[model samples]
Target: MNVMAKAEKKISSAFIYFFGSFGGILFGYDIGVMTGALPFLQADWHLENAASLVGWITSAVMFGAIFGGALAGQLSDKFGRRKMILMSAIVFVVFSVLSGVSPDMGEASAYYLIIVRMLLGLAVGAASALVPAYMSEMAPAKARGRLSGLNQTMIVSGMLLSYVVDFLLKDLPGEWAWRLMLGLAAVPALILFLGVLRLPESPRFLLRKGDEAQARKVLSYIRKNPAEIDQELASIKETAKEERQANQKTSWSSLFSGKYRYLVIAGVGVAAFQQFQGANAIFYYIPLIVQKATGQAASSNLMWPIVQGVILVVGSLVYMWIADKFNRRTLLMVGGAVMGLSFILPAVINWMMPNMNPMTIVVFLCIYVAFYSFTWAPLTWVLVGEIFPLAIRGRASGLASSFNWIGSWLVGLIFPIMTASMPQEAVFAIFGIICILGVIFVKTCVPETRGHTLEEIEEQGTNHGRVKASNPEN
Candidate 1:
């Protein structure tokens, strides 16, 4: 009986991990698909109208992402994670298809493009918030970091797959090529939408709704044995009850209340720093940056993002392996410092060797991306997912994710203008500064939550000054 129980537990864990990561896969595809497609899009649409147009076009989804993140918590709580995911998947697929097939530069096409991208942004934002939260909820304490890290890994893998498709299709030399690249997202979105249909609702979510029977059924599906399911449920229920007692009301202001203030600050601050770290600026414009640096053709530029994507995927895997082994604080510092250094070297190369071989700069950029993937890309998700309690997990994660997208939107909006107006070297140097600040913030403010249970995080979280002793807000 014990032997069979162990096998069943392992299988259940594997299933959760795979599916949890799939959510990130959608995120990755959404992010990377645009890089290659953008160059073609710019040319196809004759997008030289004004900087505002360019900014609007690029930042449109980001703008939508802000609201999407905000909506994730409320919707996930009201509608459930599985249902929201299904709905978002449909939105993602529909928008992806629309984004690809919208007519060229006509009023209708332009309007449709913005609308579709906005919808896509909503899907991306919601997924970013819910995927990690869902993954963390499903994962056991022992394996939570690794499984949640799967979201980041899938995100990178999606980026890689998108880049690969971009490369393969870059030679088609028509608007349809970009369309095809964007439309390809439909395949994964559809697969995920259908795959998750059979998966159980989150046990924690079920428990929250006072549906113990449903929660038990979910636990049974996720665990191998009925006995193990019973044990886990008891533990989870106890934890949930404690969380409910700690605070039952979910609100934006509640996050700023006595007990959860510091956590809110930490969560939101880290999320903001993540984007301010200049990751998206690089991601959004890397292909263009590569083309400028390497003096390469579009096809060649397309290949570099694919290479970068591959490096990011590998980096995420390596980071996942080490995340729980080392302190979260230590890893963040290391990653920030390394990424900071990566940006500096590239800036220096561009400045001192402006006339030197372009390949040298490209090589350094690749190294920078490789380092980023290993550190910030995956670690951020793991940290965010594990740092909050069950009661506030949805709202807190949503708010934090909102900050992340806001940062992304700002960077995406400004990168073109910054790169166009300022020297490229200066632009990168600014990112380096942000990365250094991130390192300092982690060292000073961030707490180590390595290997802690959700219950433990809630207890420690209150100690960080996020919770108040007197007034009740949420």
Candidate 2:
């Protein structure tokens, strides 16, 4: 009986992690598919003279995400995270196909494609906000960081998958290649939608709705020990009861009140900096950057993103190993410092050795990617997932995610224009400075969340002065 129970427990836990992170795969695939598809579109459509159009095609998804994130957050709070995620998966499938089949109705083709991509972006944005929250609510305190980190790992893996898919499909003649790239996202979306049917709604969310019996039943399936399950249920109940007694409703405006102001700043700041530090620019334009540096055609440049993708995946693995073991602040500061140095050194080298091989910049980019994958990429999601109180988590996380997409939107929108007018080295140097500022922000403001339950973290927020001094579990 004991053996059977243990096996069932392990299988159930694995199921949760797998489907919980699957939303990230769709997110990554849609984001990366564009990187390879854009070149083909430009060629087929004769968009060489339309730099503004090119930027719009890439950034339209992000512009839609800003609204998607905000809307998904409020909806999840009302309907449940699992339902919102399931809905997003359906949206992913519908729009991904729409994006791929956009007819070449002359000048209208670009506009059609942009609209479809924006629709797809809405799904991606919802997943970005909801998945981490779902995972954090389901995870044990000791394993929460690693479980939340799984979302990032899946995100990078999806990106790498897209890069590999793009490489494999690059040889196909004409517009079919790009269409297939955009359309392939549907496979993962369908898988996520199917898989989610077997998963339970978040127990925390269930408790919030005043359904302790259902919440307890869900907890029993996920938790290994009966005593631990009881303890977790009690903790959740206590938190929810306290919130109910306060008799205050959580709304978008509540996020800006004095009580939540600092946390809002911290959450939104970290989320925004994660993008503004310029990682997506590399993911979106690696081929272009390599083309300029190596004088290679788009065909040959396809292989280069795979190399960066591998580095990103490997670095995320390293993060999984260390995430729970170290303080969040420590990891972010170390990653920020190293990442800044990686960007700064290449620019310095370019200035001092103007004749140096352009490949040197790529080398530094790999280093920057390594540290970033391990640190900012995964940790930012982890923090955002665990930081907010349940009362406002959905809305606050959504707003923070919206801020992230907004940053991504600006970067995607302006990167081509900026690179056209300024030296690439100068642009990277600016990102390097942002990385340094990230370090200061993590050190001075971010709280340590290791070994604490989501409820405990929420309680700590009521006394902001003690947040920085909180100790990690041994």
Candidate 3:
């Protein structure tokens, strides 16, 4: 009986990992597709090259994302996690296809493309909030961090997949190459949407929504003993009831009240800095950065991003092991400082020896990616899962993640213009500066969540505890 119970628990967890990681697939595909697609898309569509227009074409999704993240909490609360995921898949399919087909502004298809990207943004925002929340809820206390990290791992994998495909297809000599690249996203989106059809609704959402039977069934799939399932369900229901009685309603003011206020500030800052740390500038505009550093032709530059993506995938696993061993706050600071130093090295090398060996620049960039993949990539998601209580997790995480994506959008939209207008050396220097400041902010403000349970982390923040108690598991 005990062994069978363990097997069931393992299968349930595996289910969560597979479904949860699909969310990362969407994230990676969108992120990876745009980087290589943008320059060619802009050229092929004959779009106006205005900075603001470029920003719109690139970052317009943030606008819809702002709404998507803001509303995801309420909608998930009202509708169900599975429903919203299905909606996200539908949105992905619709907009991704449109983005590929959009003609220039004067053409009738121009506005349609913009609208689709904006819609895609909403899906990004919603999935960002929902997937992690769902995973956190489904995972056992012992495995939460690793399962949640799976989402980030999949995202980087997706990014790598995109880069490899783009490299393979770049020389096809037809505008359709980019379209096919963007359209490939629809395949996974459909599989994800269909997968959602079979996934059990999140037990937390079910319990919170007062669907006790469904919650019991779902809990049964995870917790083998009826007694354990009953106890857990009771605790969740009581927590849900107390949460409703305490708040009565969700509001913008809820973000600023008591302990939540500090969390809100910290959460938003973490999300913003995750992007502001200048990771996207590398991911979205690596070819441009590589071109500036190497003065290489366009064809030669396509391979650099693929190398970076591969390094990132390998780096994230090492970082995940570290995340389990060290204090998250310290890890974040060290990562920020490392990235800051990495950025400076390249900028200085480029300034001092513009014609330096391309291999040297590549080595520096690979180091930067190594630092980013292990620290910023997975830890950011871990913190988001740890910081908020179940009651406010959806809304708070949504808003924080939305801000992060918006920051990514801003960098992506502006990098081309910044590179064109500002010296590459200065821009890289500015990125280094931001990373340094991020180190300071994280060191002082972010809490260490390495071994603590999500509920414990919330209680620590609520009670204003100076430090989290060490986890026995660690």
Question: Candidate 3 — which residues are off by over 4 angstroms?
Answer: 1-13, 46-52, 104-111, 249-251, 257-261, 358-360, 389-395, 452-474
TM-score preference between candidates 2 and 3, better one? 2
The runs of at least 3 residues in candidate 1 whose Cα sits more than 4 Å from the true structure, single-residue gaps closed, are 1-16, 48-50, 248-260, 389-394, 451-474
lDDT of 2 by residue, 298-405 (tens): 555788788888888898899888876888888889999998888788789989999989888888888888899998998887788778777777567777787889
Per-residue lDDT tens digits for candidate 1, residues 1-474, read 778555434445566567655877888887788788888877777664445566666777887878886787678988888888888889888888887788765645666777788888999888877787677677666666667667777888988998898889988975778889889999999988977766667888898889988788667766668888888888888987877775656666787776777666776778788888888776767878877666664545787787788788888888877765788777778878887887777678767767767666567667768777776776676678778767777678777787888888888888888777876767888888888999998887677777677678778878655444544362
lDDT of 3: 0.75
Model 3 — which ten-residue stretch has the worst lDDT? Answer: 465-474
Ranking by TM-score: 2, 1, 3
The predicted structure with the larger TM-score, 1 or 3, is 1
Q: Candidate 1 lDDT (Cα, whole model)?
A: 0.76
lDDT string for model 3 (226-310, tens) is: 9988888887888778777656666667876765766777777888998987888778767766766667644457787798888
Model 1 poorest 10 in a row by lDDT: 465-474
The number of residue pairs in model 1 that clash at the backbone is 8
